[model samples]
Target: MRNPLSDTIVNIPPSGIRKFFDVVSEMKGAISLGVGEPDFDTPWHIREEGIYSLEKGRTFYTSNSGLKELRQEICHYLKRRQRLEYDPNTEVMVTVGGSEAIDIALRAMLNPGDEVLIPQPSYVSYVPCTVLAGGTPVIIELEEKDEFRLTPEKLLEKITPKTKVLILPFPNNPTGAIMNRTDLEAIAKVIEEKDLFVLSDEIYSELTYSGKHVSIAEISGMRDRTVLINGFSKAYAMTGWRLGYAAAPALILKQMLKIHQFAIMCAPTTSQYAAVDALRNGDEDIARMKKAYDERRRYLLREFRALGMDCFEPYGAFYMFPCIKRFGMTSDEFANRLLQEEKLALVPGTAFGNCGEGYLRVSYAYSLEDLQKAIERIKRFVARLDGEKKC
Candidate 1:
């Protein structure tokens, strides 16, 4: 028998974040600041909606694009939250999660050997999804000095004739960098000039700590060229529900739906029903959770600074990217040694991209109590390292 495996599938490395998460899961009394999931459970009202759907025997599959009501609610939510408009009938489709939407979008858009400009350190899925879609992954190494925001200069430098998709992963993972309107307008100018499309992953949009989250899709001349990806996972703590959606021009959405229809049929029905409730009535829930996350974010920033580490003050999402270069070790080495010696798990920044090598992504998604304990352990580890250096 031939040893048969497609090089594309085999060559893709496993998620770097999950490797550490799994190790921490098996260890007794381990505190993980690694996983990006919200520590809060799904808001009760949203869960009640899912339960209500089940009770009413609404378990049948939705249309390939998803339940009409749910899609309308998604469109409404996007409009209310981000000032972006979409037609539920033709522009929106529910997905399993933001992950599935991302995969299908790439598949629908990429021609073989097309180049996708991905900025790092970003969410882990972008590179692999682009690769599996038969696209070339062109990485833009986002710099710490810029707070990890992707500049228009960097964007222009990476563009070429083959560049087809620019992945905008703002309120960025690993690094909690966000692009405000001015920042986005600069990039949009380039995209319009170059005739490129954008896949804007705004999964963390609702988690922004600063002013309201801005969508590049809302910029002039951008809506037709942007596929906006967002979901309830971060804001409503609905990660387990596995519901997300993509909104784009009808033409792009039609192609994406074809792939989704054949591959996934539709997102889970119960999840979609619950998501409708989430969108329609979950604003207060978002404010409540965002407040909690903000408290944790500030606490972590203060603690990290007090511990004598250089941490970027994250204005979005629930993670902080702290520079660990002072420790004179690679991100992996610091993370592994901290986990082994202190029973605290932090993801190495390199997990996101090589640009993350000197940093560590510490999620503040845990409770203040857990974060306090983790900080204590981390401080002890750092102190020990400093003492050794002095010796």
Candidate 2:
């Protein structure tokens, strides 16, 4: 038999976040802060909407683009939340999740050998998606000092003639970083001058601890060149709803929709109906959950700092990237030893990218009680490491 896999697919490693999550799953009495999922249930109103759709016998596939109502609501959301306008009829698309939008956006944009500028310590899917799209992944290593926001200088250093797209994974995943408007303006200037398109993943937009989350599409001259991706998973606790959206220029979106229909046909009928409700009546639910997450974020930051852990202030997302360097152990080693000795599971930093060494991604999506328990275990585990260091 011939080799069963394409070389491109074969070389890509599985998600680093899931490794510790799998181990902790089988271990007894384990406390996992690994997965970046919300602790809240899908808000009652949103779930009820899905049930109503099913009760009404609306369980068929939506259009290739998605339910017209949902797409319109998505556009309203962009307009109302981000001060940006999109045409639901031609410029918006509903996807399986933000992950799908990322994949297809790359597929729709890149040709053979196109270079994509991807900053490291970002969400895990960007590099693999670029490769699968036949684009070369050029990594821009974000600095801790920069709070993981992409700088124009860093972006300029990596761009080549082949560079076609830049991925803006702000309100970032593992590091919990966000690029303020000024930071984005500088990046916008570079992208516009270089004539690059961008994939701005703003799935965590609603979960920001700072002020309102700004989209790069809001930048002058950027609306036409940016694909703005977002979803209900982080904001409305709708992760299992398996829904997300992208707002792009009509020309680009037309191509993306073609791929979406051939591959997926449409998003779930029930999810789309429910998402319409989420957009229309779920602002309060988002405010409630975001409040809880912010509390948890502050609590974790305080606790970690009190323990003398070195972590910069992360203004967005629910994850914290804390430096584990003082313990003189690799992030994987530290995470593994904590799991083995204390049955606590947190993902290793190196799982994100090579530059993520000496750090660990800690999620605040768990409850305060669970977080407190996890902290007790971490406190004990690190004390042991402190003792070992003395020896």
- lDDT, residue 301, candidate 1: 88
Error of 1 at 335 (Å): 0.5
Per-residue lDDT of candidate 1, residues 219-302 (tens digit): 999999999998879989989989889999999999999999899999999999998888888989999999999999999889
What local lDDT score does residue 337 receive in model 2, on the 0 to 100 scale? Answer: 91
Per-prediction TM-score to the true structure, in the order listed: 0.99, 0.99
Q: Write the per-residue lDDT of candidate 2 for residues 1-391, one digit (tens) a residue.
A: 9998889888999999888877787998999999989999999988999999999999777889999989999988889999999999999999998899999999999999999999989888999999999999999999899999899999999999999999999899899999999999999999999999999999999888888899999999999999999988888888998999999999999999999989999988899999999999999998998889889889999999989999999999999899999888899999999999999999998888899999999999999999999999999988888888788
Prediction RMSDs, each to the true structure: 0.8, 0.8
Q: How much is 231 displaced in model 1, in angstroms?
A: 0.7
* CA lDDT, every model vs. true structure: 0.93, 0.92
Model 1 score (lDDT): 0.93
